[model samples]
Target: MITLTLQTIGGLMIAYAALRVHHRVYTEKSIDKKVVNEMRAEQIVGIAGALLLILGYLAAF
Candidate 1:
């Protein structure tokens, strides 16, 4: 039960991070400090989310 919840939350976070990164890469005109920080943040989120998802899958089995 908890595993399922974790998987769902992780999936959502991954999706959000991917979207943010995509937007930052395509829409931004310049690589400013703020943009770089945001991209790094998004990458961290994506990595954490992926780890959560992998853990959830392992817990399921």
Candidate 2:
């Protein structure tokens, strides 16, 4: 139970950080678009990780 909670919290933090970085990129047009794309990809990964974390927690019971 504690492990699941930790994983969920960690995933949320990762997703939030990704959002912050993603937004920061918008303020700088000189940055590469590929970098922005990578940020978007990481956001997707964070979402998927959160889903897996939830499923694992449920399965553990």
Candidate 3:
């Protein structure tokens, strides 16, 4: 039970962090090389977070 709870929390935190990164990019007014790179990185991180969340749920069940 503790492991399940911890995994869920960890997934949520990672997902949230990815969302924050995405939001930061959205709020920026201009696009540049650095921003484009950050966007690509954020997408990777977001996908990773989603995968983690899915795996955590599967493991918990």
Q: Best by lDDT, which number?
A: 3
TM-score of each: 0.54, 0.57, 0.53
Candidate 2, residue 55: how far the Cα is off, in Å = 0.6
Ranking by TM-score: 2, 1, 3
Show where candidate 3 strays beyond 4 Å: 37-41, 44-48
**1-61, model 2: which lDDT tens digit per residue?**
7877787778777767766776677556677888767766876776687678778777888
- Comparing 1 with 2 on TM-score, the higher-scoring candidate is 2
- Top-scoring candidate (TM-score): 2
Model 1 reaches what TM-score against the true structure? 0.54
Instruction: Give per-model CA RMSD.
Output: 4.1, 2.8, 2.7
TM-score, candidate 3, is 0.53
Candidate 1: residue 17 Cα off by (Å): 9.8
Clashes of each: 0, 0, 0
Tens digits of per-residue lDDT, candidate 3, 1-61, equal 7777786778788787877777777667478878777786787778787877778687776
Global lDDT for candidate 2?
0.73
Candidates in order have lDDT scores of 0.72, 0.73, 0.76
Off by over 4 Å in 2: 1-30
Clashing pairs in 3: none
